[model samples]
Target: MGLFDRKIPFKYLLMGIIFLIVIVLVLTGIWMSYVNSSDNLRENAYRLRTMTESYIENSFQLIDAGLKLYDTAYNHDMQEAFAVVMAEYNGTGGDPSRMDLEALKTAIGGMDVYVINESCVIEYSTVPADRGLDFAVIYPDFCIYLHEIRNTSGFYPDRVVRDWSTGTLTKYSYMPTSDHHYILELGLQSEYFEGERKQPSYSVIVDEARAFNPYLEEVLLFQKQKRLIGNKTYVPTPEDHAMLDYILWENRTSQEVRDTGQERTVFWEVIDLRDPDYAADMSIFAKLTYNDALLSQELARLGVLHAFAGLLLLFFGALVVIMVSRELSRPIEQLVNDVNSVASGDLDHAIRPVSGYEFSSLAESIQVMVDRLKEQIRKCEINEKRFMDLVQFLPQGVFEADAEGNITYANRAAFDLFGYTQEDLERGMNILEALAPEDHTRAKETFMAVLQGKKTEGSEYSGVKKDGSTFPIIIYNTARMVKDGTITGS
Candidate 1:
């Protein structure tokens, strides 16, 4: 008749369905949270890697351009100083042996110079070791300079040579006197390229790396790092040296991206400075590590928000289920109790209506049935009273028993005969109890026979009173059949 009229509670079923929905939502939230975090991390890693490489390239380019300017300026100044020394030599009778070469060398800033007589022989010299040697014998390739000075009587371009054994760069230049009597030779080392000029140091490069890229954590500069050869050896070959130079050049030009790490990434590249100016050429490795602190913080906040949302979903889902289940079941439960009240013969009891369309309709139907039953019961009571008045005045006692041998109605004369009060009969006193103990089984059989429509005549049996006194009595039973002809009682 009602949703929960049987033993199982419908609210538990509703709660179970809600629990499954909550579990699915929680799992989906967790999955989406991890995916969001991982995607953010990957994107941040890529962005920072590109930023770091660009900063390194820009910084190195600035330093390289500055050094080249210094180199070009120094070369022009040195050629002018050589021209001055040659003009002064032509005034000394075209003989450097008679000239003030020491004063001339000191006045020109203590540079190395030599004088070659017309015989192509080293004569007066600032460097004592080169004083008496034949120029053609020491430098067999001096024929070109000799031919130029002898025929054209002009100066020669500066030649740069790296003395690898001594780790010094020597610049050689030859100039003829005005009278064409001598050739002046000059040599300057790599230091003379800028004459104590300032250059960007490793520390400066490290600072520049950080200055340009704010996300940089630290810069690691490995100077003169040897090339890796096989597994156990670190011997640097020409090819290895050349490869490092190429890598450095490619990095500065193209800016290759490197491997990335979590939270922070380390990027490294070789910086080559193998040009002729250096006494000893070597490469440096610049390792830049970058950190995106803001991105990391954002991911942390995302995690917290994900957790909070999941918890809120669970709490609100449970509350809604509880409220909804109670709302749905409350009216049905009230209808069941009202129906039970009518079943217990409380025909006059009022049936209270409940909420909702279906529940309200069920309550209305129950009330209509109760009102019809009350009318029927009123008519039955009037007929029963008339019957009882005739039976009450008669000498024979009358009673009615149900199918289970429980007395439903006992007339006044029947109650007086059985020594049972009206209250005792109203308390559902069993009619079988009025019979003698030995007659109980026979009485039960007789009741069954009447319910099955097998017997109609009354029988004589020994009846017992409440005081334990026995007497002979005749009991009659007839099936109490409903509209469907089903026997409900006898």
Candidate 2:
């Protein structure tokens, strides 16, 4: 009762079903590719996100251990100059009132110096105007950093940043004294900062992550100042600020997906920054954005390829079906037609040989049957000819007629007995015609009765001759039927 339940040719039905299957296969392949691509995108994004978080966390630890990755010799030289200056001004504790600031700068390789007390205020500096610069009021993030450094004896280096007041690109470093009395600050402004800024840094490392994953659109790391940096500088939007705030406030990971098929995620961790009171926490948050453009291209390409391949399958499948169906049924059709011809009484009709082992055998068997039948017919015909020759030599007359008493055959004795020439017999003759005018009615009745399956025996009657004469004759007539039910006389 389904839609395809109706009767149809086997060849066409098979072709239809196979073509439909090809179409379904093509579409399913395309759909599966999309699903797999989506899953791969999610997996790849997760790996990159996890790697970024681990790299930054480990990098910070290395940085804490005085791992100056950017420069080796230059960093050692800076440290050496800072040690000499520290010894020269050790007693002063960088007390601005006791030392001449101009002479201090010349002795320290022309580097700016800022000495801060426990209050994290710039109590003295080579630049006099920088005096009394309260870090807590001006730069709270930098102030937090200095407070952490005042408890450590290791020198800490920072990246090149433009000093807001002087608009000079400067590199800064800090060191606390043995007694934790003051935090030493060193600032250098040189052409080296410009080349170093353009060199390969951690920001480039984050951006290069995209090489490993095509779906990765960007990776952004937020500094203590809440500034986002990646390949190039990126200005933070309201959404960016809100997302960072939410992640930091929750102190956990967060993920979001955009309606435009962009997946955005932020990962955060709270690690002890090695500060006194164990009260301060350093927050490192990385934001990763995943895009679907490449996935879109791949899906489209897969669709087109599947479609083309399906079409090819259909086209070539149709050709194969046609050839196979013909090869299967053609020989049988020919055999059927030959059988029909023989059934219609054309015994001489030949059975044409066909291809295939089964068909050839069938044709040979049919041809053999026909030959045997023809041989039987020849023997029968020969026996009948001999019978007719024997009947001709007999002294008794014999003949054959239809149910209507029409003469179909006659022997020599019959022609002679009826006084009719062979021409008269061939033209037209009947039992009634052979009888006298007075016996005609009886002859007709006798012929009909004989045809009705009644037995007929020797009957006396007056037979009329073609010469207009009459004779007394005894007829032995019988009606018979043949295989096709055609009535005849004997």
Off by over 4 Å in 1: 1-27, 77-205, 208-215, 222-265, 271-284, 290-305, 308-398, 402-448, 451-476, 480-489
Specify the highest-TM-score model's number: 2
lDDT of 1 by residue, 360-439 (tens): 88899989988888888889999988987888887778877777788887677777887888888877778778998888
Per-model TM-score versus the true fold? 0.52, 0.54
lDDT (CA) per prediction:
0.67, 0.69
Tens digit of per-residue lDDT, candidate 2, span 349-461: 99999999988999999999989988998999999999988989989887888766788888898888877878987888777888888887777777887877788888899
Give each model's clash number.
0, 0
